[model samples]
Target: MNRTLEIELIDELIALKSARGLFLEEDIGHAPVERYASDDQFDTELELVFRRRPHLAAHVSELAKPGDFLRVDLAGRPVLVTRGKDGVARAFLNVCRHRGAQLVGENAGCQNRFTCPYHAWTYASSGELISAPHFASGFPDADKTQFGLTAMPTYEALGFVWVVPSPDSSLGAPFDFKNYFAPIAAEVSELDLADHVQVANDRISVAANWKIIVEGGIEAYHFKIAHRDTIAPFFEDNLSSFRSLGAHMRSIIPRVSLARLGDSPRDGWRLRDHANTLYSLFPTAQFLVQQDHVVLIVANPLAADHTELRIATLVPKSEAGDSELWMRNHAITRTTLDEDFALGESIQRGLTSGANAKLTFGRFEGALTAFNQSVADTIAAVS
Candidate 1:
């Protein structure tokens, strides 16, 4: 290899090591109430952080394109999002202009227009009120232009969509969440996520606080106990070494397993020793990178104690068809994910019982704590 190339390789290795090495147990477990499931402050804080933080809002903004649409219920408000013809993704309240019925009910699909079912009111994809059942005479004062769907504040970035449900929200100033993610963003970019396409997505409902599901993804402390048979065999149980960002954290697990994975592989699909990277993006999203695939789970809180987890598996684009490998991979991921959801739901049940007023986050899990604190600060500021 050239001398310059060798030097660059050495630098990259050192940087990777440094990124994975600098975490403290004290940091993971700090500020217990911040992440406590029963803490009302947790919900309040999260609402503020998500609604007010412009930088955080930018992550989903960058992913927008013309006609791109997604539906979201952020902080208890239903949002219908779309990238208009001009190539800007915008979010609007999904309610119909007449009698307030929801216009779009399906999860997501491309459309040139949205038609209201109640009275057959129709609107363009850009949210313009173009037609109605009785266009000539519903009411003389009813102007089509005045009845456009309500627009919400929106921005797309970082391969995700984000929305604020309030029409009066002051989130217009451009803030890039990718920048706030900083050095970690650069490190993650090494995975070349753009080349990967979603191969499988499993949506699940969990009877737990959304944050609890997030905690389950971030910390390795529970692996030896909660996931002994399932995950422990594939990951290092020791929590001494993990990496942290102020509001994000990732754990790297080597692929070596006790199952003789290296030698016993004669088969169709086998679990191999590989680097597994897990990332918890602040309050809700969890990104898990296995050797052959990337699993992303975003938890959306439906109620104080109910949450929905959206799981998407991204595989190399070449493996697009419905092949045996795809099915096998999806099955394995589904099983592991179900197990995690079970744990999260049961934990939420325990938390709601008032048996424990606080929950302790391990030092390696402090990124969870930091995120909770960030939520607290945001809610406080908004309040």
Candidate 2:
């Protein structure tokens, strides 16, 4: 967020701390239990929500130099993003044109050319076909120019790579980065992610719906109780703030130390020192902003009740020498998120028992309703 707006929010948090109040919505809201337990709904989300929108594939820092490349699965389609010799970022289908074999199997690496393991078809980082092993008399009539990797719509903005994932015209065609990311673009720019690099990371599978995992970050109603052993002591009990950013949501969870800032000068106060800021980046990603590093959490839904969670801690390149601090940040995030996701697993297991017709969101937990509603709206817009 911009410094002016961040300072404004910090001031609000300070005042709320003094009054012992909570930032809430106009009224309470609720979501249905089936939203997290139904097969049909899960399929609809994969098709309508994930496929039809741009996905946060990787940070620009991940592909910072020429020949840098990374492979990712967005909505089940394997994609390869590369920083070519021209210093431009491009994305492809990650499939060799000669055969259906994957172009890159490793998650990330730096290579100017990729060779197909099946047919030895070589391709440049620019997606151009360089050579084939059996071009002499094997396929005399073949046009090698037609066998380059298929390109997808890709944009590099806000220090991240955004891809449509699908080359089809059915959805996400004519990708519009400006409008799609407009709501939070300025805020993200203020974060200067381009100047940061990933220092620590973890990946795990959680037995819960992706939505269940996301809802955990947007509310603090469970922080004190669910995280009593980890982060609860540092944060105020049931006191947090949130606001909608188009399809995204931003929540600021103030620490207990913030109460000491009452009537103090804001010039010396840093938001990250007094609170943890979480950004719900639309579909299946989150940014956990902390004091000296940012933790990115991306969820890949394997099923209605299973998700692959990847966490990466990014610190400013200037501070990359502080390996201990970055590692500590990653560990704390991993521990706290593990607690929240485990609770989500328990909720998912009980969601099918027909215990409640609808799960209610308290006034302070209103962002959950907003997020679910956005999911429903996106899915419904297709038909």
Candidate 3:
């Protein structure tokens, strides 16, 4: 983060401390229960919202060498992302051109070529078809070039790989990361995310809608109640601030220790020293920024009542040593997330019980409203 922005967010924190207040909206917000329990709504989200958004497929470090590859599910599409011998990252539909067989069964590995189990059709890491089992005898008139894997829109920057899973024409044609992020580009650049290496990886499945889990991350209102024995004591009482980044969000949740800074002459102050900054990379992911490391989380909604999160702990190269420390941190992070997600699951069940028509968001928890509004707006725009 820029020092100026750090100072600004801190000063806001200091003010909230003095006033014993939190960020508030002009009015409370209500979201219909249907948003979570309705099958049609979930289908629309998968088709409209997820398919059209950029997914953080993998951190570049995961593909440290040329020809490294990983298979990921983006939206509902099976995607194969590869770091080619030419040192460029690319994405393709993880389907065999010959028979639509699901190719690349492994989750991740270092391979320069892939062979279909069904027909033995081979493809290079660059997604070019290399050969067929019997080119001379079978379909000799077919063009091998036309049988190559279908390319998805792919962009690599700031040490991360981004791919739009859909074939939307607007995201194609060179597929640049839209300039929508231009405003916060400098702020994100200062984090030097590329300088980090992932130290841990885990997946957790929760019986809750994906948005419910996302909403939990952007608010501190439930910290004391939901994470009482875990992360609650360390943070303030419902105290945090947030700002919109295009359709995304950035939240600053301050710690109790921040109060100790106490009007002291400040110089070279850092936000991470006293708070956790959370970034919602809209539609699918969040980057929980801590002083020593970052936690990359991607939520994949499996159904109206189920979601799976892929969590990776990233540590700066300077702190990548001390594997035990990162392991402990990852464990603690998982514990806290489990606490939040347990409650999320409970909320989903409540929504199905027909107790309330809509859920309420207090004026202070404005980010939830903004997020839901963004979803509604996106789906509405094309409706």
**lDDT of all predictions, in order shown?**
0.62, 0.86, 0.87
Name the regions of candidate 2 deviating beyond 4 angstroms: 133-143, 168-172
lDDT for model 1 = 0.62
lDDT accuracy of residue 117 in candidate 1: 79
**Candidate number that wins on TM-score, 1 or 2:** 2
Rank by lDDT, descending? 3, 2, 1
Which residue segments of model 1 deviate by more than 4 Å?
1-23, 27-39, 42-46, 50-72, 133-144, 168-184, 188-192, 240-246, 255-274, 352-354
- List TM-score per model, in order: 0.76, 0.93, 0.95
Top lDDT prediction, candidate number: 3
Pick by TM-score: which candidate is best?
3
Candidate 2, poorest ten consecutive residues by summed lDDT:
164-173
TM-score of 3: 0.95
C-alpha positional error of residue 190 in candidate 3 after TM-score superposition, expressed in Å:
1.9
Model 3 pairs in collision: none
Q: Candidate 1, residues 38-123: lDDT per residue as tens digits?
A: 44654564456555443222233223356656666766677787767776767778899889998988766667688887988888
